[model samples]
Target chain A: MHDRISSLGEKKLISRIISRSRSVFGSSKLMGLGDDAALIDAGDDYLVLTSDLLLETRHFPDPGRPRDMGWKTVTVNMSDLAAMGSRPEGFILSAALPDLELEFFDSIMDGVIEACCHYQAPLMGGDTNEADEIILSGTAIGRAAKDRVLMKSGARPGDLVAVTGPLGVGAAGTELILSGKSTEGFEDAVERSLRPVARIEDGIILAESGLVSSATDITDGLVSELGELMDASGTGMRIYEESLPIGEEVPEIAAILGMDPLELALYYGEDFELVFTAHPAGIEELSTMMDIHVIGEVTGGGSIEMVDKDGATYKLQVRGYEHLSPA
Target chain B: MHDRISSLGEKKLISRIISRSRSVFGSSKLMGLGDDAALIDAGDDYLVLTSDLLLETRHFPDPGRPRDMGWKTVTVNMSDLAAMGSRPEGFILSAALPDLELEFFDSIMDGVIEACCHYQAPLMGGDTNEADEIILSGTAIGRAAKDRVLMKSGARPGDLVAVTGPLGVGAAGTELILSGKSTEGFEDAVERSLRPVARIEDGIILAESGLVSSATDITDGLVSELGELMDASGTGMRIYEESLPIGEEVPEIAAILGMDPLELALYYGEDFELVFTAHPAGIEELSTMMDIHVIGEVTGGGSIEMVDKDGATYKLQVRGYEHLSPA
Candidate 1:
C-alpha cells in the first residue's frame, strides 16, 4: 500500500487487481478479468461481459462533441465483446453528467441510440449521478457459443498474425484534432476516429472457422495488445512492418505533424480493429470472405520484434496505456 | 434541446431516456429500464443487472473514507438486485480514479473484496480510467429463477405492506456528519450509514413464498420508493406511522437537530431495506422466520396516505432523490 501506483505501472496494478479479486464463488466464471471481456458459463451460451470508461476531456479531443463522445463510449465497450467473438446482446450505460443543456444530453443519447442500432444491441437501462465532469461507463453483454468464445490464449508457433483492417487512422484523427489541422483532405481519418466500428463479423467468422488461435482488439496500440495476447498464450510475434495496412491519411497526417506514420500505426492506439493469429490455410479462407492483412507470424521467441522492408529487425516497445498516475 | 436538464428535473429526464432508448433488439428483455434492476431472459433463469455510481464529494459524506465508499458502492448496486429477489453472482467495479495515494486505492479494493465475500458474489472483472475525480460505479449481476423474479408491479388492494427492517439510521448518519455533530451518542447512526447492507434474504423469501405481490428497495426514501411501486402497480398505500420501526438513534438525533424522527424515516433514504406488499398469511409465515414491521396496506384509492397516532390522516409526500440538475 505504501508503494505508489505509478511506480507499479498500469499493467502491474491491473495484475494486482486481477489476482486480488479472485473470489470464492467462482464456479460459473469461464474467464474472469484481464481479457478483452469476462466470460460466464451461462448453460448453452457463454455470457460475454465487458465494460469501458470514458471521461470527457480525458478521452475525447473536444468537449463540445457530445455525440461522438456518446458513440465512442458504446463502441469501446462493444469492441471488447467483438474481440471475444461474441454478439452483443445488450448495453448498459452508466453516465455521470455535470450541469449541461438538455440539447447536449439529447445529442449524446442520439449518438448512443445510433450506435445501438448500428450494432444491433439494445439500450438496456442504466444508472445516473451528478458529478463535476461527464464520465460514461458502458457495460456490454453478449452471448457466444460455449465452444466458439475466443480468448487471448491458444496461439502456437507458425501461425500467421493478421489484422482485420488498417491501423493509424484513429491516431491520425486524434492528431488532426489535437493539432487543429483542417480535415479537408483527411476527412476519413476524422470519420474513422469518431465513428470507429468493431470487427464483430470478422471475430465471429474467426471463431466459427476454428482456424484462429489467440485474438485481441487493437485499442491500446498493436504492440500493447500483442503483449497481452503473447503473455496469455506464452508466445511472441514477429511483425513485418511492410505488410501492415496503414490508413490512407496516416502518412499525410504524420508529415504535417512531423511524426512517423509507422509510429502512429504501431503505438498510437484507439483503432478498435481485431488482431488475431491463425493457420496459413485459415488465413487464405478468411481472405476470401473479407479483407485481412497478414502482417507477421507467431513465434516461440520471448520478445516481440518487427522486421522492416530492409530486413532490419528491432524490438517492438510495449507502452501500456498512459492513464493512471501516482499521487 | 433548448431546455436545461435541471429544468426538466431528474424524473422527467429519466422518463425521456427510457422512452427514447427503446431500441430494435426487443426479445429476451424481461424488464428493461425503470425498475430496481434490468432483467435479461436467460434460458432457465433471469439475469439481473444493476449499476450505481458514487462520486467522491457528491455521494460520500467524507472523501477520506475510501473503504466505506467502496463498501457502499457494491451494496447500493446489490440493493437493486435484492429488490428483485436475485442472488448476486458477480460484482464489477467501474472506477474512474484520480491521482490518489496507492494506499487509498488498496483500501477501496479491500472494501470491495470484503463486500463481495459478505454477499457471496465473485469480484468479476472491471474497467478503470484516470479522471480528475473519484467516480466509483459498481455493477452487480445476479440470477434468479424466472418465475420468482420480483418487479415493481403486481400489487393489489387490501394487501399488507411491510419493511424487512428498521429505517432512518442512514439519514441520521448523514445528518450527524453534515451537521458536524459528535457521534459519541450516535455512533450506531453513523455506522449504519457507512455500512448499510441490503436485505437480500428477505427479498428472496418474499419472492419464493409466492405471497408477496410487489417489492422495491428503500434507497431513495420510503415514500419515493413506495411512489415508484404505486405507479408501477397502479395502487396506492396507507401507511401507519406508529407501526414504523425507526432506528434507535433516529429520535435522539432528530431531537438534537430539531427535526422530526418521522421525517428521517419517511423522506431520508439510503436504508437499503425492502418494502414489499404481501398477503396477511404470508406475513405470518415470514414473521416466524425473521423480524418484520407491518407498516401499511395497499389501497385502491390512488393516493398514499399515512395514519398517525392521533388518528390523523395526511398525504405522504414523495420527494425523489435530489441529484441531477440543469446546467
Candidate 2:
C-alpha cells in the first residue's frame, strides 16, 4: 500500500496544503508546515497537545464522500478544543492517501483549508504518506485562560443542560445515503453529517463569561455523550422530549427510513456539537451569542430521565457507537 | 472504512495503546485519551507538537516485519524530536492495521513499548483504523526549556561534523533483502536494517552539552540529510570518506553483494543515526560518549565534498528518496 501511495508525490500534496495554510498567529513559531518537524514557542506554562485519527471506515461512515471525510477529520479535533473551552491556535495534519492524483488530493486539502480558515486556525505542520485506505490524523494545540478551561468533571447537580445547535441532522442524512436516497434538497442536513462545525466560538464565549460549569462535544449520539457527561460530573439529568430541537430535514428522512425521529436524534453520532452545563443565571448571558435552549437540569440521582410530550417519563436509553461494543 | 472501523469495538488495538499511557506531568488534564476530545493542562506556554508517519515501504522494507515496523514508527519521531533536541514526554499513536490479528498487533506494540522505555516517553493516546496497508503516525509532545531548542540552522562555517554511530549497515542489509541473498553470518547487520534505533539519548546529551551547532537524523541517507543541514545553516561541509565509520557487519554484506562499501555508507538511507555539527572545543567531551566520531569539517563552500582514502576528492551527491523521484 505504501508503494502504491509512493507513486503519488506526497511532497507535492504537502506543499499544496502548506501553501494554502495562512499564519494568523505571530512570529514566535520557529518552524511550521513543510519541515520534517515543527518547532513552537513555549514560555513558563505547560503546553497542551492532542492527536486524533479518522479512518475511512471507522470515524466516518463507509461510502462517505471524500470532501466530507476531510472536513470531519479537522472538525472533530476542533470540537475537542471546544470541549476544553480552549481557543484553537494551530494544528498539524497527517494524511495517508491511497493514490497520488493531484486533483483528488487537492480536493481533500481544499476541505481542510476551508475548515482552518473558518476557525481562524493555521496549519502548523503535517505529514503525508500513502496507504491502501485514506487515513487522516491531526494534532491540535490551543490556549486557554489559567482558570477558565471547562472540564467534563465540573458539573454540579443543579446545572442547567444546554446544547449548541440542533441534533439528528447528520445521522438522518447518513440514513438517507444508506437507503440510496437523494440528499439534493437537504444539503444542510447532509452536510451536518459531512461537515459538522465545532462550537469553539460558543465554548470560548461561555468559558470567558464564567458561566459554563462543564462542557463536552457530541461526537457520539446525544444520549451517549450525555451519559459520559453524567458519569464524569457525577450527576444525572432530566430532559423534556418536547424541548428537543430536531433539524428540519431530520423528521422527513427519519419517516422515510422508518426510524423514530427522537431515537435518531438521541443516537446520531459525529455531530461535533457542544453540550454544556451552566448555572441558571448564566443561561441568559450564554444565549446572547447564540440561542442555547434549556433542555434539562442536572439532578442528584445518577440516572438520565426523559419526559415525553404524553406526560410520561422513562429512563433515557443510549444506542450509538461504543468503543468496546461488539460490531 | 471509517464506518467499519467505528463499528468495530474502539477498545480493540488502539484503546489498548492508550490505556498504557501515563500522564506524569500534571493532574489538571480533564480529558486524556478516551473521549472524543482531550483536555490538556493549557497553561502559559504555547504547546509544542510534532508528528511523523512511517510507511511500510518508504520508511521500512516491504513484506513488513511487525517488530521492526513498530520500532521504526517510534524511532522516526524520536529522531525528529532529537533534531529539535526536545525530550519527548508524550505521544499519540495513530495506526491503520492491514491485519487485525492479535499476534501482529501485539508485536507492533512490543516495538512501540520498547521505544517508549528507551526514550522515557509515554504513549498518552492513539487512534486505530483499518487500511489496505500498515501505517503508523505518531504525534509527540515535549516541553523544551523556553525557546532554547536546537534547530538545523544553528550550524556555522567553522563547526565540526560528527555522527553518533556507524552508517550503511542498514542500507546494505536492505540490499541483501531486496536481492534475495542469504543472510549467512551477519545477524547483527540484518538487524540494523530491520530494527534501526534512533539516537534519542545522544540528542538529549548533545542538547545539554550545548556543543552541537546543528543536528539531524540520517533518515534520507547521509548526503541528503547533510544537504538539509547545509541548506538550513547556509553552509557547506567537507567529509573525509576514509574517516567514515562503516559497521563491521556492513563490510561482509558489501563484499558478498559486490557493492561499493563507501557508496553504500554515503547514499544508503534509513540509518536512523544522528548526524550533527559542533564546535571544535566540544570534540573531546563528545568522544566521551561511545562511538562518537568526527568525520568531517564545516566550510563556507555551500556544497558537500568527500575526500577519499587515496588523496582524491569528489563531490558527494544525493540519490536518496525524494517524493517525485523516479522509482
Best by the DockQ measure: 1
What DockQ does each listed candidate score? 0.61, 0.11
* Per-residue lDDT of model 1, residues B1-327, tens digit only: 366677876656766777777544443452747888878778878898877788888778867788988898899988999999999888888888776678988898888888988887788886667777788888788888988888888889888999988889888888888787787877777877887898888778877877788899998889988888898899999999889999888999988888888888998787879999888888888888777899999999788999999989999876655568444
Weakest ten-residue segment in model 2 chain B by summed lDDT: B30-39
Highest lDDT scorer: 1
Error of 2 at B99 (Å): 7.0
lDDT of 1 at B19: 72
**How far out, in Å, is residue B230 in model 2?**
1.7
> What value does DockQ give for candidate 1?
0.61
Give the alpha-carbon lDDT of every model.
0.83, 0.67
Interface RMSD computed for candidate 1 is what?
Answer: 2.1
lDDT (10s digit) by residue, model 2, range B1-327: 122322222122223222322222122332223211122233422134567777665567645577777777877777777766667765556676554455566567677766765776655544454555567888777644434355666688888999888888888888888778888787776777787777767777887777778887776678877877787688998999778898777777888889987777887776878888988888778778656878898998889988889879878874554433323
How would the docking of model 1 be graded? medium
Task: Give TM-scores for every candidate, taking all chains together and pairing residue i with residue i.
Answer: 0.96, 0.79
